[model samples]
Target: MDPAPARLAVAVKAQARALGFDACGITDASPPGSAPHFANWLAAGHHGEMAYLARNAARRVDPRKVLPGLRSVVCLAVSYPGDHDNPPPPPALRGVVARYARFTDYHDVLAARLRDLTAFLNGLGGAEARSLWYVDTGPVLERDLAQRAGLGFIGKHTNLLGRTLGNWCLLAEILTTVALAPDAPERNRCGTCARCLDACPTRAFVAPFVLDARRCISYLTIEHKGPIPLELRPALGTRIFGCDDCLAACPWNRFARAGRLMREHTRADLAAPDLIELLRLDAAAFKVRFAGTPMARAKRRGLLRNVGVALGNLGDPAALPALRQVAQDPDPLIGEHVRWAIERIEAP
Candidate 1:
């Protein structure tokens, strides 16, 4: 409520916009109302293999645990262009990557921008402005903070959505010692629209605003380490890296446009990649192709596993040769999925 800190907060938001952030707002580093629900979600095994979410549970509920003197949290959302950010369902065997992964790794891109923002905020707040920042990597509950900061409301699909920014955003945060006036939280405006829930190929949403990661295509393709569940394979379709059906299904995306930074980060090769080409990637080839992109997180075998599922769903038979070559892959996980694909494709 102090004038000096309020002025600094306004300056910080302006600097963030200047640095290409689509939205910015501030909230106190207090415990969020959703913390108990998050605990229940984790206790019910909804987080899947992302054990880190549970490991840092305390810090996530209380930002003070992450930064001992934390006072305010700066929440930011940067939207990527709709063209590559909202890729339509693939035709036949064409593989689809999530909108976020189609471009360079956002961690790298957003980190640099956040660093600059941090420096500017520190300068404005004087020596008392100690800060810490991260792009989706820390114990911070970013989406919850963003909602409290008024950047957007959490949609029924559990992704953040703004009137203008939609759900196509990469969230990042800065926890600072400076006491900035907080923005009122955005009210949930999703109403009864069930488009995101209906659009999910795997039906991962257990209920409104709740996601079961174990059944989520994005979690299976990108986070799960072992073979994907047999029943879920067919639903994966041709998404080899990550899934975006829910995010793309949101009507708010109609307002999304290609900003200069987003356009520069988009990679043409990642848009509608041929399944055959991706299935052919060896460990070496996979690294080279996805080096700077978000897809690299899947590693060679993880990606190959998803590709096998796509091939099976493709049922094109043309992918048989590719599947056969990896049938005996040294990695048992990849080999298992490849054999499943062969069986599915060979099924009468």
Candidate 2:
């Protein structure tokens, strides 16, 4: 409540920008405004296999549950727009990774920066300050907090889009007892634009501002552990990792500049990977290839499972040899998908 904490907020934002964060703002660590919507989403089973969302539902509403007596939340964004040189891969035997995952894991990148911000705040607030930070790994309603902090409004497609950064930014949060002054919330800017919703390959957006992860290509390719549903396989197309159709379709992205820090981390090879090569990756090879990247999170089997669907959708006979090899593999998850790919290629 003190004016000193208000001044500290200004300094924190300046320092965060210096550390390469694209945007920064503060909000009181009260319950998230989206708690009701989140509860509804979970009750409707829209979250699918992401059981952790249900498990951590309570903690998301109240930051104090994760960090006792938390009074301020410092939210930050770092843009990861795809490299200007790296356009979407041609729809062929090539598989596309989400632009964000085309680089080093954002979790690691954003967490390190948030830690530095925490140390700065702790030093300013003295021993009375307690701080904890998260980079998408926490049970926080990040979009709600980010919107409340004035960074951006949550777009109808369910992503936070800033006037400048569009939907191409990653978010991080720091919860602290330092009591920084909060920023005013941003007004909703998505008046009539529904391009993001209309662009979904799998019709994941059940309605404006609501997403069904059950049918989302990103969720299917990355989060869902078992085989992808047959109904969604054709929509999976050549996207092996995550999908960016909705985010890329946002008209606001016309204002988005290429990511400065993330540009250096983008791997050209990952921009449009050869599906045949990905199918050959055994567990050991997968780890070695995508060691520090977000792609590693899917593991070899999950990624290969996705690759089979993509190859099937491509219906490219060039992939038949690889799919046949994978069909004989010991992992039923991948083998089953490989068999499906073979059927699709062989089908009239």
Candidate 3:
């Protein structure tokens, strides 16, 4: 690599920081060799109903297929740290949403910043600027690319753990035709740390550096579209959107700080939503409430379904009315979950 290219890479990093990314790094766009592991994971039915993972297996392993002539992957991390854990539910509330869903959807926020970065890179040296940006909407092995870019290591929980920002940050990638100098992969910093592994209520981690998505609370609530596995519901606790137990348990988060650009994105109403209110939400109401938030991805039916599970976990008789009301929901999945909740709440 020419020194000029290296210098340009350094300048790009600075520009990325100025553009509001918490951290940035460049890596050569290459197929990550995690396909065997992914294949095994899928074969074991660990991905549950997230069939998309299996559908794009080849494209996900290689960024080049998604964007031909991809020479570099500019990975960015944006912190969305909260001042506190999920908020306490109201006296009669039964569900609690995870903190990440509390604010504006990170996909929009981070994609905008990535567009700016790509524009900046294009202006430099008059490159054609052919590039694609992804905020979890593309077939890309983002965490692996982040690690290759020296941005972070894939922690035991399988999240990209930035040395400075921990796992509370969102990842976005810009695959470009520009051939910026690449950074060496970072060393794993999770030495002797098993807190994340031990904190998993579902024992999702089959072993170090591996996660069985089927048993992960985040996957169960947010990714799985059908009825949640009976055995995993009890381990979900009150997490209705996603789970952060493993991320929170990581020791490196002690040094993590909320990114200045995303300070306003901290936990808001969704820190812990009232389960009763969530269950009562119709499609229109759910859309209005979660218009700009990540929770909207779950859609009205999906979210209400999770709320039913949370209500079941609460096992409070006071939640009977809310559960029964949703039991007649138009969506079969929501109604099924509501019935499940009714059984759990009425038991004993």
Instruction: Name the best candidate (by TM-score).
Output: 2
Clashing pairs in 1: none
Clash count list over all predictions: 0, 0, 0
Candidate with best lDDT: 2
Candidate 1, residue 290: the lDDT equals 88
TM-score of every model?
0.96, 0.97, 0.94
lDDT by residue (1-348, candidate 2, tens digit) is 468978999999999999889899899988887899999999999999999999989998888899998989999998876446578787779898888998888887777778888999999989888998889888899999999999999999999989888888999999898888999989889999899999998999989989999999999989999879888899988889988889888888888876577776777788899889999998889999999899998999899998888888888898898788889889999999999999999999
TM-score of 1: 0.96
Backbone clashes in candidate 3 total 0
Judge candidate 1 at residue 226 and give its lDDT.
91
TM-score computed on alpha carbons, candidate 2: 0.97
Tens digits of per-residue lDDT, candidate 1, 266-312, equal 78788788887887888888889889888889898898889888888
Q: Lowest summed-lDDT stretch of 10 residues in model 1?
A: 81-90
Cα lDDT, all candidates: 0.87, 0.88, 0.83
Q: What is the overall TM-score of model 3 with all chains considered together?
A: 0.94
True-vs-predicted CA distance for residue 64, candidate 2, Å: 1.9
